[model samples]
Target: APAPTPTSTPTSTPTPPSHAGRVLLPHPDFRLFLAIDPRHGEVSRAMRNRGVEIFLLPPSLHDPDLISSSSPSSLSSSASSVGNGTATTATTATTTTTPNTPNTSTPPPPFHEEVRLLASQGLFGSSRRLRAAVVAAHARLAAACVRVHKRPPDLRELAHFAQLASTLACRGWPALAALVVAWRQIYLRSLGLGGADMVVGLRVLAQMVREAGVGSTLGVAG
Candidate 1:
């Protein structure tokens, strides 16, 4: 009998052994930030914000202390007030009482609090999507590189392949997908999936550019 006909939805192809490479790479979230184009400045910024959020708040999902700690100056003032329970007034001499001065003593929110707020808002979701996208981009690039017997790809190159291939695959392009998958396979074989996990973020961005097609390229247009 002939092999059974395959019948899975087009959402995702079979993810070949994702564990091929064994080296520990950087946090996948961090790598995603590097893969986006600054030319798509807004998207790139969002991705970075999300990655930072995930790193800062992975386990707790929410930190109430951080929420209340946002206003650094106010919190400090409150603590001081509780400690001293008294106010000491100082005399001020002003040459020009007619002019009004702006208040510069207010402190900005704690930087980490801002980051936490951004993370809670799904800031890092796109970055995660980008990481998954690399699955396709690497495949295509590896095939092309192999045909030419080019140098082995780095994490950045692999990421570019995944970015390009996945974006194209989403748009109903099988040829592009095949190339991406093939290239990624080669990359995986060389380093083992686990090993590839430790690549830097910037390198991942370079890879995305390398594998980007016209649409994906345009997505990052300056």
Candidate 2:
């Protein structure tokens, strides 16, 4: 009992601090407009997987309102004219005169021209919008690849932007996406994305091109 060793009380080890899991919200400054339909489910999933929030724009967004509001007097006159069969007479007159009028509806610019115009207008200024467009273009390319078994004609200009954006997005860097696009526009060459990133980006572009059978038309081969 002399030195009956004071029974040493075992001290409890301190528990390690617990860290709550972080919930990654979508980037706050960007908004993407996508149609809400089953057809776009794959693209929607891809955007979300990249931490982008999808905003479902109604199909109406694509349809501009062609009907202009009319005054009551105008409406009444229109109805009365229809009742008097004047509308039919007018249609007949238009049909008789139609052949003389030249076809004035201009075709839309080619897809590449559209892309160039959009880029020039600073439409791809934000990472979010750029990313959304890229996703769309990528979907188009994939579909073309499957259906035509080659790079579709429309995939050349559009798909290249998609490839650049996708490459940066995959690297977890959205900010760099716009930079790359700007570089391509101004310099007409791929941005020097360091050794590894450059290699990865080129590989991704090559794969996309190969799958779509776009070859040198994508403008990414250089």
Q: TM-scores of the models, in the given order? A: 0.20, 0.20
Point out where model 2 deviates above 4 Å.
1-155, 181-187, 190-222
lDDT of 1 by residue, 1-222 (tens): 999999987787776598777778677565433443322333456665666533333443465543343333332232211114564432222223222321112223444433343233332223322222333233333333444445435555544444444444444566434444534454544444333232322233344333222222112111
Q: List the residue pairs that clash in candidate 2.
A: 151-212
lDDT per residue (tens digit) for residues 1-222 in model 2: 476666789999987568756678878787666544321234645676866554543342232221111111112122211234443221101112254322212111223333333333222323222323333333333333334343332435454554454444434554444435633542133333344333433443433222222211121111
Judged by whole-model lDDT over C-alpha atoms, candidate 1 comes out at 0.37
Q: How accurate locally is residue 6 in candidate 2, as Cα lDDT from 0 to 100?
A: 69
Which window of ten consecutive residues has the lowest lDDT sum in model 2? Answer: 66-75
